[model samples]
Target chain A: MEGPKIYGELFGLPITQTLVNTWIIMAMILVVCAILTKNMQKRPGKAQVIAETIVTVMDGLVGQTMGKDKMKFAPWMLALIMFLAFANTSGIYGLRSPTADLNCTVGLALMTFFMTQFYGLKSKGLGGFLKGFLEPMPFLLPINIIGEFANPVSLSFRLFGNMLGGGIIMALLYSALAGLYFFPVLIPVPFHFYFDIFSGLLQSFIFTMLSMVFISGAMD
Target chain B: MEGLDFIKACSAIGAGIAMIAGVGPGIGQGFAAGKGAEAVGRQPEAQSDIVRTMLLGAAVAETTGIYGLIVALILLFANPFY
Candidate 1:
């Protein structure tokens, strides 16, 4: 349908609705996390319980997917999943999802790409990392190199396309029912359920899980 | 203007054609789901793990379909033919 609204120019750059929504989401998450984690407690209260559950679940996920030794990545992976879940579901609140923007998804995917490479190098050393490219056969080096570059492109497009597709479908559905009484209100709930809630959460999980797999795969 | 109209018509057809890529993932996912179901039937205790692994693999398989969708969307909303 329509592109994200350009609110105004900041310096030479245009400030868009996507950026505003992203900032709002960031602040909301920050506030919620701060409130949940307030004060030290040996016996956890309700808020602390929520915080502890989130941390424990994330740690468990990282441990299961990436192994116990890679528990160091749990916090980063938790932050990623939380941001993605919120961004993908922002459509529910009538805010355009920041993840629908190509720039946002690409930036995230690039972070994964860099982490994968950096960790690979760190664990394997420069020689071993290069040797990885030559594995199975030296002739497959170019293919391996291309495969490495393709990872970020595929990861970014996978996320961007899914969110964008869901947004487009929801937009089309809303407009088609706009003139009908009660139809617009009733018909879109299931669509919203699938696209905004179910698909949003699933995609976020997939993205986080893939990142963990990639990063850990590189390290080991 | 006449040539522009022809280009637009061709782009519309191209968008539809791009979506043909969905067929592969549809078939692949169905096959994967069947196997996943079989695995669950064999070991009910590991159903959660089986489903999780199935979903992850299915998502990866769905990437080609997503690429097709992206091309179609670009052609429809952000057409360069104009």
Candidate 2:
């Protein structure tokens, strides 16, 4: 498929604008994380407040969904949600979202797949893990294995497709706006509101929640 | 031997093929929605928060679907090969 073209080559590697923007975003996340973590406060500072709110919300979410036993996974889930939320919302700027790249999405999905497997193996020993597949029907072992194999493929593609769609629409919308700025404000604003802001955060949450669901299901 | 016509038809077909990616989010979001409904039904008091979380998750699920649409649209209107 003819998608965004590489602008140039750096050391034989085709570096697209998306790749550069991802580095920029990565740098920003690292800086922010460092700053936020370094500044610890008991009374409460504004930055700490913001960070605490995010952690509190996500922690509550993990506790509610996965039960108290899985609270350890909360921090990982929080990091995933924040990283993805930022990655998806990066489209608001002129930069290409990293989520648009299959590499990024697939990598994230692979991590989730591994985490699910890891947690499953931890909660249930190797024999118990194998027994999970044989549930409901011992005859369906092969099919169940195939279904487990397909999880990451499906999960990765789901996020990739959605982010790519929003980015493309936003691109087209901006192009449309360039030619016709006088287009009804309501029409464009709501579209941006829903597609970029809402969809970005929503997708990240879904990714985390579904990852949790799969892991919990496996362990159970 | 109308090669150009074949390419155009192929792209049109390709556009449709791209949209097929929409199935991923459709099923994913539907699951989120059903879970949200179930959560709300069980605990009506937490309806607002449940709905909020559900929508957030559904929004993430919606992204890939949007990507497929973008590909389809590009194929239709901004075909690079053209």
Candidate 3:
């Protein structure tokens, strides 16, 4: 709010920098795919190697999290992770992470929650889906419904908090040490790693894995 | 005295709201943890992988909680709302 102005249009939505950045990431991914696939490299160039590595790493992660039966979800997980990892570290070069915004993070969380519900229903079927709501108690259905509604609240805030925290701290720290460079960078290095790299990647993985779990659990 | 007291009350309310953010991540991270345990039970050979993935997911799951803390801190130290 202090940084960017949010305006509502015919769509009746507040468009912020995070939304713009989401589009930027999507466009970049598409462009990268076109370029990478345009020159099919078997031996591998720098870009190709990096792409492969990212995919392979995420694929391995999905395999571990969701099992071989659900390996198809790997691509989705990889894309989300790569986007988040890049976006989180965007601040390293004087940019902000989209996850730094409540709307952006909440939007993603809602998407995950929706996917969780939809796929859970899809895999488990309608009857199974309804049945899942009654798990461990027929009397707890109302509470479970409330729990389902709360998924996005939790998911969105988790990401938003960490990114915003890191951002605010870095800003405060950097300003406090305007005259000096060493301590600001050195001291905050761990912070950037933990908040941006570690937390960013971890959150992405968690989001993807949970989505899968929700689907499986719903269907089961 | 009334004005100062009111400000203090508002800040306290904001802090409480911020802490409420922790609730969401708590449930989410717990879900991730349970899944990780289940995964390990199924495939002990993949225990390392399971742990790595679970820890990774749990860490992500923990972000929202951090966010709530940030908001609470902002309320305390950098309350734009005030």
What is candidate 1's local distance difference test score?
Answer: 0.92
- Candidate 2's residue-wise lDDT over B12-36, tens digit each? 9999999898799889988998999
Candidate 3, superposed: residue stretches over 4 Å from native: A1-3, A6-15, A31-35, A41-46, A179-187, B2-5, B8-54, B57-71, B77-82
Residue by residue across A84-158, what tens digits does model 3's lDDT show? 766776667566677787778777787778778888878878988888889888999999999888777776776
Task: Score residue A81 of candidate 2 by CA lDDT.
Answer: 85
- For each candidate, give its TM-score against the true structure: 0.96, 0.79, 0.74
Model 2 CA lDDT for position A88: 86
Over the stretch A92-148, how does candidate 1's per-residue lDDT look in tens digits?
A: 999998999999999999999999999999999999999999988999999999999
Among all windows of 10 consecutive residues in model 1 chain A, the one with the lowest summed lDDT is A178-187
What is the C-alpha lDDT profile of model 2 across A1-220, one tens digit per residue? 2355687998998987667777888888889988776768798888888888878988888888888887988988987887898898886665677887788889999998998898899889999998989988999999999999888987788788777777767777777777864765666777778877887777787888888888878878
Model 1's chain B yields a TM-score of 0.97
How far in Å is the alpha carbon of A107 misplaced in model 3? 1.5
**lDDT ranking of the models:** 1, 2, 3
Docking quality of model 2: it rates as: acceptable
What are the fnat scores of the candidates, in the order listed?
0.82, 0.65, 0.94
Q: Which stretches of candidate 1 lie over 4 Å from their true place?
A: A181-183
lDDT of 1 by residue, B1-82 (tens): 6998998898899999999999999999999999999999999999999998999889889899999999999998999768
Each model's Cα RMSD: 1.3, 4.3, 5.5
Listed for every candidate in order, the interface RMSD values in angstroms are 0.7, 3.5, 2.5
The true-versus-predicted C-alpha distance at residue A91 of model 2, in Å, is 1.8
Which docking band does candidate 1 fall into? high
